[model samples]
Target: MAEVVEISDPGDPRLADYRDLRDVELRKHLEAEHGLFLAEGAKVVRRAVEAGHDARSFLMAPRWLDGLADVLERSDGPCFVLSEEMIEQVTGFHVHRGALASLRRQQLPPVDDVLAGARSVLVLEDIVDHTNVGAIFRSGAALGFDAVLLAPRCADPLYRRSIKVGMGAVFSTPWTRLPDWYDALPELSRRGFTTVALTLSEDSVPIEEAVAGVGRLALVLGSEGHGLSPRWEASADRRAIIPMAAGIDSLNVAAATAVACYAAARR
Candidate 1:
């Protein structure tokens, strides 16, 4: 069972894991160094624990205790109870859900492991936005994509903002980064999955036609500003584009993923 400890000082060393969450680079380095990630809100916190992540500690206002009582009771870690103001001071932002948890990150499974038995998967190429990564995971999970694959440069799906935006979908989805970005698509092809690259290339066909009759498929999406690299575009078995009205050439990566996943699910 967890022990509840009341803390008034924002700078207490015990609260170090919960500090300066708004500082992206600092938080990235800190979290990576400690092999931990933060889960915000009661729901995401509970999801993280339920997904088998061990909690290092929990920080919350007194009022949030009851709502998360079951979680705290199940956890053997310490729970720091603080005033809302103190939490805001430590975290550098108002914690609207009034709860935050630092959970240990597990070793990511290899790409082959994540791809085992997967029929439909989403491949992300250099998507740097945590929010977009999270949204893509949520959409892929909801639409029945069996797994997700990320390029070496993609954002961390377990990052706090990504996890929050994904509503913990990152925990449920099977994913891992490709070891070799250059051969990612071809490797998937060798594993019996058709590679469909979503882009605006000259040879691109409609999304539905591109994915049709593919028993196993890997739908690849690119970065925010630039789409897929020329090597990836040319290497794909089929290039696909989502038809749009005038003045709208493309959708945001997340929006595009949702649309493509929906189509892939129905195909």
Candidate 2:
């Protein structure tokens, strides 16, 4: 069971993991240095723990305790009970979800291990928005994709914003960063997957046709601002586009991912 420690000081060194969450750069450094990631809300926190992550500590208001009592009972870390105002002051944002947990991060698995038996996969290249990454994971998980592969420059899927937006879908999804961004699609092809990239290239076909009858499919999405790079677009086995209304050329990366995942799920 977790030890309940009521803290009155917002500046306590023991609360380092819960500090300055609004500062993305600072949080990134602190989390990386400590080999940890945060899970926001009772649901995400519970999912992280259920996914076999080790809890470093927990922070919550007195009102949130009963709602997360089972989680506290299962965690061996300290639970710092504080006022709502103190939590906001410490974290630099109102923790609307009423609870937060810090969990130890595991070493990332290799691409081969993540793709061992995947029949349908989502491949992301330089999509750095935490919300988009989280939304993509949620869509892929909900739509039955086998795995996800990220480019080296993609945003951290384990970031607190991502986890919260995805409602902890990252915990259930199998994902890892590709070591070689330039050769990623080619490598997937070598492993017997048909690399279907979402792009606006003139030669691109409809998404349904591109994904149809594929034995093992990898759906590739690109950065929000530029879409797929010329190198990546040309290297894909097939290019596909989601036919949109006459005026709109494309959807937001996350919206596009959900639509694409839906089509791929039935393939």
Candidate 3:
């Protein structure tokens, strides 16, 4: 049985970890120690607990706790019960789900290790929006990308908003950041990976043609407004695109990522 600590006074020091309405630094600390991030809502918390990560503690409403009794019993950590108002006061925001748990984030496999036996990988450069990051991850997980390579400027996929938008797909997908965006290209090439850039260049080939000749492949999608950087575009063995009949300028990065990821995986 998990210990249920009732928290009435918002000033209680035990609740310090959950304080603040929005503190990115505090969340980042969770990543430093165990790579943990808050999994909001009873459902996401339950899934995280079931996945066997060290669930440090849960700040939950009494009513919500009852529904999670089975999972709570299985948790090896403390459960703090708080009133709706107290939770909001501590978190500094309206927590709609009435329940949130802090779980350890596991270390991802190295880029080299991930690429060793991979058939397809998606490389995202300078994608900053958490929503788009989460959506891309959801699509990537469903579309069958072996792994995702995030550049230095990409949003943290494990952030609460991203995780929620991603529907917990971020938990299963493997991602590692490349220290230097350009430095990693040669490494990919050495592993027999054909780097394909999704761009709107005249010399770029159609999606079908590009995939036909490649074995191990890496598809690169740029940031939302800027698209791929000129240097990154030049890094590709060739460029590719999804044909549009109506002269659409381009797809949203999230939608484009899904199309590109699925196409690469299907090949």
lDDT by candidate, in order shown:
0.93, 0.93, 0.81
Residue-pair clashes per candidate: 0, 0, 2
Give the Å error, residue 11, model 1: 0.8
Considering TM-score, where higher is better, how would the candidates rank from best to worst?
1, 2, 3
The candidate with the higher TM-score, 2 or 3, is 2
CA shift of 162, model 1, Å: 0.3
Candidate 2 per-residue lDDT over residues 147-208, each given as its tens digit: 99999899999999999999998999889989898999999999999999999999999899
lDDT by residue (tens digit), candidate 3, 1-267: 678999889898777667773777776675566566777887777776776667778889899978899888988778899999999999889899989887766776677776667788888888888899989888988988778888888888878878888887777766788877776666677778898888888889888788885788888888888888898888788899888768677889898888887777767
Candidate 2: worst-modelled 10 consecutive residues by lDDT: 242-251
* Model 3 poorest 10 in a row by lDDT: 27-36
Q: What is the lDDT of residue 95 in candidate 2?
A: 93
lDDT of 1: 0.93
* Model 3, residue 167: C-alpha shift (Å): 0.9
Model 1 poorest 10 in a row by lDDT:
241-250
